[model samples]
Target: MSELDAAVAAALSADGHLADLLPGYAPRPEQQEMAAAVADVINQEETLVVEAGTGTGKTLAYLLPALLAGRRTIISTGTRTLQDQLFHRDLPLARQAVNRPVRTALLKGRGNYLCLYRMERTLESGRLENRALADGLQQVRAWSGRTRSGDLAEAPAAASEPALVPRITSTADNCLGQECPLYSECFLMEARRRAQEAEVVVINHHLLMADWALREGGFGEVLPQADVYILDEAHQLPETAARFFGLSVSSRQLFDLARDIRLEQQREAGDAPGLSEQAARLERATADLRLVLGDGMRTAWRTLERPVGEAAEALAHALAEGIAALAPQAPRGKGLESCHRRANSLYQDLQRFLAEPDEGGQVGWVETRGQGFYLRLTPLDVSEQMAGQRARHGRAWVLTSATLAVDGQFGHFLERLGLDDARTLALDSPFDYPNHALLYLPASLPEPSHPDFAEAYLQEAQTVLEASRGRAFLLFTSHRALQTAADWLARRGHHQLLVQGAAPQQQLLDRFREAGDAVLLGTQSFWEGVDVRGPALSCVMIDRLPFGSPADPVLQARMEWMREQGRNPFATYQLPEAVIGLRQGVGRLIRDASDRGVLMLGDVRLVQRGYGRQFLHSLPPMPLTRDPAQVRAFFADQSSTSS
Candidate 1:
């Protein structure tokens, strides 16, 4: 091994500092091997896509190499939980072990921090619609004085009233930049700063992708250039990159712009009555568009009412009028100047969103989410834009995740990221899956397409939950199926049913843990990132293969492109995506070495379909069984062992 390789290997070895720093830490060959590989890739200045399974200790494996290499690095994670863990705990331990002075910073999305300007403006305006928001605002006010970092997660009030978040935080479009009175004291600016002070930066995928998007747009990068970039949970990047790379003009943005314009008028341009009038006009136009585009599933933009265009035009005109009004008052104060800049920028975005060619590489669609509507144009294929990012960033990239491979191949992920020539490695999980877990594929169930499928799937879930004493995750492919299961379970009322939408996610999880035997039913969001170990979560039943919706406009567009290239969409696209998704859902079952659980595969397609082997081969080495008696015996053995 080279000197750096040897150094990394030694750091993670049996008698190394890692053993001294980390309690219960011992020599693990997988970790050492991964660390050496990471060191090699960083030294070579190339891209490496790796899959280190759940128990492989991938974080330390990469961190040791990153720290020891002495490269300016940016590590991005998929979830805030992992980001916080890495920044607060794991990175510190690794730094201590390696004895490296790596200055690290954690950068979250905008909403995580309290915007001082917005907080003060909101407080002065006193625009609380309800008592809860009023109380939450006061709480944030109290916490802001004490919070050194200004992350809202530290404030209990923001935790209770999440709706108050957008009111107090600032997004890229609304942030006042260096002109804000509190710019020097801005918490988000400190968190999202560049490379001079910090050697290593930890951020979530959203921010990383947003930075890439900004660079691609020629607007400049949000993050500083680094020698190496490590993306943990990298499987989530493709979709996130796609969204950021697209054009978005939402009802929320328009409404917020209007609200901010009104606030600035009252504060900086009190004599300009036309500014307030234009702001009200923009607000009304936004509401009218949301009404015309009424709540349903995502609709193709072309299919919306012509009045939708009219309302959007009205909004653009109002923004134009606001910009004209602010241009005169712009010299009055920083607030007026900021409002003028924002109106001009948003107007350009709305025009582009409206005029984006439908026949090009982008697919235009609109969806109403809750009280807001979003007009978006997503790229049909992100591979080219992702390639553009690679060309521009030009750094050594390490993308590691538990779900990056399908049937032990990296073709799907590499294609998605346009990293075909990049080196790939798939590491076996360090857990004893055969001894600790079982994959039970039930016999004689209807295919996911059949009308009787939902009922049959629930019956199987019920059986598994009963055998495991009702501690399980009933994961479904669709919210409709999840709702159906919830209604069915509610009607039966036998087991303690914790439905997804019935409460907040953390509350549901806490309840599940406390109840000890509650079955948590959830859809796509619950399939990944949820880790419940021990006997509290013993069974995980999945309703069907998580295939991308054929009705999805983006999926359809991609499929059309694939067909034009003489490829089968199912064979090349749908199957691999579904396989990776299934791997993620199954991975939720076995979170730790001592954690044992039964994974109930409800979709009969596993045995009947030709592509079933893809998913089965991609999964960890859990013993598969077809017999219900065998499944019952497995759970029985677990119960007896625990007793």
Candidate 2:
């Protein structure tokens, strides 16, 4: 037997703290093979893309190999939830089970650490909110005295309040950096130092991308080299990558920095000129931008240059004058210096866009989404950046998700990752779909584009929700449709409503579980990584096929780029993206083999449109039915049997 295989066998036979690793925790044949395959990849220094299906013990499969690889490994997860689980629960147990002497560390983004400098500034200034801010500061003061790691999660009631949280938090823009009084004891710097020496470092995707974006230099930088990198919950990478590579500077940031400066100066007895005037300048810039945007119902994105119309030009000039006035008066310290640098950089960026419009990159504006405004510039496609960086780093990169494959191939993913020489792998889920889930497509609904679409979709949803006895998640492709269905369901008043945005997502989920026979109305965020096992989630209702909005700036540019290359954007780009999104939505239904549920898609285009078959083929091969009664019958059978 190979050395890696022998090591795993020894660990499997050990007695340890891991509850899942006891004698009762026998691995299924497929799980064993997956674990062995993961080991082989690490030992041979080969890139792998293994899709360990849910319940295939993928976490253990990779964690064991990572420990056995006997090298510095960096494990990055797509979400904070999974990162916490791995560091707190999985990794500790895996270490004991394997009985290794490996040293490890958990490193989250800088925002997670208590910014002692900022906290002190807020406390001394006394410009913070009210009694709640006082109480929060008191907690931070007490916790800071005893805490070693400096991670904010150590504080009780930290995550509950965002307002109180931000008052004590520090950002790269406002950090004191090397000149700060607390530089020697800086939490962020300490975390990075620990990460560099530790054998294994745990981080999230955003931090990983931030490291890539900033490279190894600049404020709050990450450690440089790693032997292996494993990313869990890989499905969220595409959108996350898009967001990190995109650029947008908000007016709120300027306002916050000004507020911080005014407060800090008042406490420190230091005279900083132009603080009030700078704040006003930023406020005026915001107002000018708003006036240009107006309250128009329709919004359009213009190329950075190309005369943003006359009104946009006026606003752009106003912003330029205001920023220039404030740039000279910024604080002289390194922290404020960084802020100044960024401000000057943004000013130059705006000038370039205004003067040279087609500046050979992606630049667009999104609605400030509120009374505030936001103008942005982002790369058209991150594929080249991602692929080039990974290839240049010369590390084995593995991208795995249950939904990565489109039509039994990885071309879409390969193209996006810009990987020509990387290896690929795919694995099927172990669940028996024929018995566990049913793909129910309604025959009576009109086309999605029809005027009667919302009502027709809601009617089918009502039937399915009734059949499942309100143990259903009614997902909508658009927020408008979600609100419409929510209003209709509220009027009907048949089941308890646990809608999104009414409460925190986890709280809403908790209430949904508590109220077993209830309906949940959520949009895009609910489509993935939402686990409601057992009978709590017996049906999933998708209002329409998930597709990227054609008018979206980034997606539109990518589509145009693909078309220019003699490629069919719909077939090459849109279809695969939609398929992956659909799979994520549908996969939320059947989490475990014993957990049975019905999936209802209200969009009739799945049958009418030729591309619909491509989407359907990506889903689990479940028994398909167009009859609504048959869906009702399956639930009835489950109810009867349960009773």
Worst 10 residues of 1 by lDDT: 157-166
Give each model's whole-structure lDDT.
0.85, 0.74
**For residue 188, what is the lDDT in candidate 1?**
86
Model 1 clash pairs? none
Q: Candidate 2 at 159: error in angstroms?
A: 5.4
TM-score of each: 0.96, 0.91
C-alpha RMSD for every candidate: 1.8, 3.2
Candidate 2, residues 152-266, lDDT tens digits: the string is 8777574337766666667766766777888898888898888999998889999888887777235444754887778777767766776677665555655565565455434
Report the C-alpha lDDT of model 1 over 339-423, residue by residue, as the tens digit.
7888898899888888873667777888888889888888878898888778677478899999998888899899999997789
Best by lDDT: 1
